[model samples]
Target: MPERRPTRSLPETLRTLRALRTPADPGFWRSPVRGARFTAVLGVVLLVGLTLLFVTGLLSYAAYNPDLNPVNDKTPGKGWLGFYLFSWPTGPHWLYRLTQGLHVTVGIVLVPVLLAKLWSVIPRLFALPPARSVGHALERLSLLLLIGGALFQFVTGLLNIQLDYLFPGSFYTLHFYGAWVFLAGFVTHTVLKTPQAVRVLRQGIPRGEGGTRRGESGTPRGESGPPRRGTDTLAAPDPLPATLSRRGALAMVGAGSLLLLITSAGRSFDGPLRRIALLTPRGGTDPGPGPNAFQVNKTASAVRITPADTGENWRLTVRGPAGELRFSRAELLAMEQHSAELPIACVEGWSTSDQRWRGVRLADLAALAGYPDRPPGVFVESLQRGGSFRKAALRDNQVRDGRSLLALEVNGAPLSPDHGYPARIIVPAAPGVLNTKWVETLTFGEL
Candidate 1:
C-alpha cells in the first residue's frame, strides 16, 4: 500500500496467495519411517478396531431404548441415525457389560496406534496443490473430515470415561451427530484407499526396498527412476537417517496398546482385578469392605438423597388401569419375595459381578396395578429430586422378565442408604440408571 504497487487480477491474486501457503518442496518432510507400508499397516488395524467401535457404540445407544423418547432418548431429531435402533433384549444378563466394556477398553488401547497412524501420514496433510482435480478435491475434503472426526470422537469418548463434560451442549447429542459426520468421511476414505493399501502391502515397495529411493531433487522414484507421483504423499523424498526401524515403530505402538489394555480392562471385572484399572475413573476407588461394598456411580449425598427422604414414611405408589395402591417398606418386603443374581452395568462401561439381589418382581407389581398377565411398559420414578434419569421407562419385555425386580436387599443384607435403601428397581440387562435407585413410584401402561 505504501509503494502503490500495480494492481493484480483476481485469478493472479488467488494464485499468488496459494503459492504463499503451499509447501511445494518435497524435502520439507524428513522422516524415513513415513511410507506406504507403515501407513497401510496402521490403517488396517484401525479398519478393524474402528468398525468394532462403531458397531458397539451403536449397540450402546440402542440399549438405552431411545424409542421410549423424551425419557431415554437424549438425542432429539436424530432422524436417520435412529434407524438402526431396536428394542434391547433382556437376556444373557451381561450383554451390555461385555459390549460397553469392549467399546471403552478397546478405544483406550487404540490411542497409541491411532496417533502413530496419524504421524505416519502427516506429510500428506501439507502436500502442495491442495486439489489437482475435481475428484482430488473431494478426496481432500474427505481426508479432512476423517482426521477431524477421529480426533473429536476419541477426545470426547475419553472425556466421557473420565466423567468430564467441558464441551458445550449435551454430550449425547454432540457425540451422536459427530459420529455420523465422521462415519461419512471414514467410509469414503476407506473405500478409496483400501485397494491401494492392499496392493502396497502385497506388492511391497519396488525392488523390495523398505524405504523409497529419492532422485537428486528430493523426489521419489520407481525402479526405472520415473518421478513417482500420485496420492502417495507419505513417501519422503529426502528422508533422514532412521533412528527407529519401521518394524520397531510398529512394535512400540503394539506395546503401548497392551499397556493400556492392562490398565483399563479391569474396570469391567470384580475383586482384585478391578484394582488394576488405574487408567479408568472408578478404578482406584475403595468403597470399603462388606457384602454391599462395590463400585457406585454416585453416592446418596452426591444425589442429595437424605435419610429423612427415605425414612419409614416413604411409600411406593403404584398406578394402573384398575386404580392406585400404596405400600410401606414392610408391605413390599412381605409380598412374594424374588431373588436374582444380576450385574448392574453402566453406560460409562463399569460394572459389578453378579450380586444376590432380592426384591418383589416388577410383573407382580404390575399385577397389583391391574394388568396381571403380559405387563405393559412401566414408567418407574425415583425419589431423586434432580438428575437426568429421575424417572425411566422400561419396555414390556423388561417388565415381563421374571429376573426383573424392585430390589429391597443386596447380598442377603438390607440395601445401604447410599444404595437405594428403601427400594430400587433392578432389571436384567438394563443400564444402571434404569435400575432407578431410591424408587418411589411405578406407573404401569403403554408408554
Candidate 2:
C-alpha cells in the first residue's frame, strides 16, 4: 500500500509565496560625518581635475583653428593629464586623441559617484520651504541650474556616443557652449557650498543635530518626555533600505568590476590598440594600383577630371591669379618633401587609423609658385569638372600651420588613382571638405 502525502491549499501556497516575495522600500544614504569630508574632498579633486581639462581643451581647439586665434598657434600641450580634454577637431595627433579618450573614460567613473552623492544629499532639498526669501530662492535656483546643466551634459554626451541620431552639429555646438555654462554653475556651487561644508568640517557637526534651525521658538519650554532608547532612537530612516542597499551594493560591485574590465578593455580596445585591433576596414579596402593605372602621357588636351571617375592620367594643374600656370609630374616631385601619419576625421563622426602622407608642403609649393615673399590664399580644384573647387584662403595666421600638406602617397606607397592618384592635398587636421582629393588645379587668390 502507498502512503499519501499531505498537500496545502493553492491559496495558502500563493499567500506564502507572496509574503516571501515582498520588497522593501529604498531610502537615501546618510553617510557618517567623517564620510562627508572624504566624499567632499574626492569630489572636489575630481571636479577640479575635470575643469582643468575643459579649460585646456578650449585652448587646444583655439590653437588648432588659427583663424580663431590669429596671433598664436602654440598652446601648452595638455601633457600627461591630457586625457581629460574632450573637445573636438581631434585629428591625426597622438596627444589630442589621448586626451579625448581619457575624458570619456574617466567620466564613466565620475558618473556614478556624482549620482550617489546627489542621492545622499537629496533630503536637504526639502529642508526649507521654496521661495521663502530672496537668498533662498536664488540658492535653490542656482542648485537647480547647476544640477540641470550637469545632467544635461552627462546625458547628452553619453547619448551622442551611443546613439548616432543627434541633430547634426547640435552636440558639438552644445558641448562647446555648455562647457562655459557648466563652468560658471560649477564655480558658483563650489563657492556657495564652501562655507557651510567647511563649517561642518571645522565644528565636527553631530549627526542630524547641528546646522541652522528651521523655525525657532520664542521662549524656553519644559521637558516634553523621556528620551527614546536603543539604536532605534538614533537610527536613521534607513537612508538606503535593505533591498536597495543590497541591490545598489551589488550594482556598485558590478560597475566597479565592469570599470576594471573597461580599463583593461580600454588598454586593448581604446586609442591605437582598439582602433587597430577591433575595427575592420569597410567599403573600399583595396584602392587598386598607383597613379599610373590610367596613363595620360599622350593626351595633349587636359581631360576634365570628375569625381565620378578616378582614372589614371589624372594630372593636377596649378594656375596663379596673374595667369601663371604650371603642370607636369616632375615639377611637383622636385618640390620639398613632407610627411605625417594622421587620421582622416570625418564630420560624420567616425575616425580611422593614422594615414601616412608623402608630398610637397603647400607652403613650400606656394613659395615656389611666387608667394614665398608674401602670404596668399590658394584654390584647390578636383579633377571632376562639375564639382565645386575646394578653395582655402590661407591667411597670415594659417600660413605657418604645419597641418597643411599636399599628400602624394599613403602608407609609404604612391597615391592610388581612386585616392586622388598623382597628388592630393592632405590637410592634416582639417575636416573632410578641406582634404581635397583628385586635385586638378591650384589657383592663387589675393583675398
For all predicted structures, in order, the TM-scores are 0.89, 0.59
Tens-digit lDDT track for model 1 on 108-133? 98999999999987766666566666
Model 2: per-residue Cα lDDT over 1-447, one tens digit each: 999886889998997776562112112324332134433544564466557546644644442342422221222332433334332342435444344444454444456656755654454564434455676677678777677777766776666645454644556556655666676778777775555455445664322321333322311111111223211111134443244443454367458635533442232122444423222211122223443222111111234544344434445565553456665556667767788776554322234446678887777766666676554656666654443223433333334456567887777777765456667776655544446666767765554
Could you tell me the lDDT of residue 371 within candidate 1?
Answer: 94
lDDT of 2: 0.49
Per-model lDDT: 0.84, 0.49
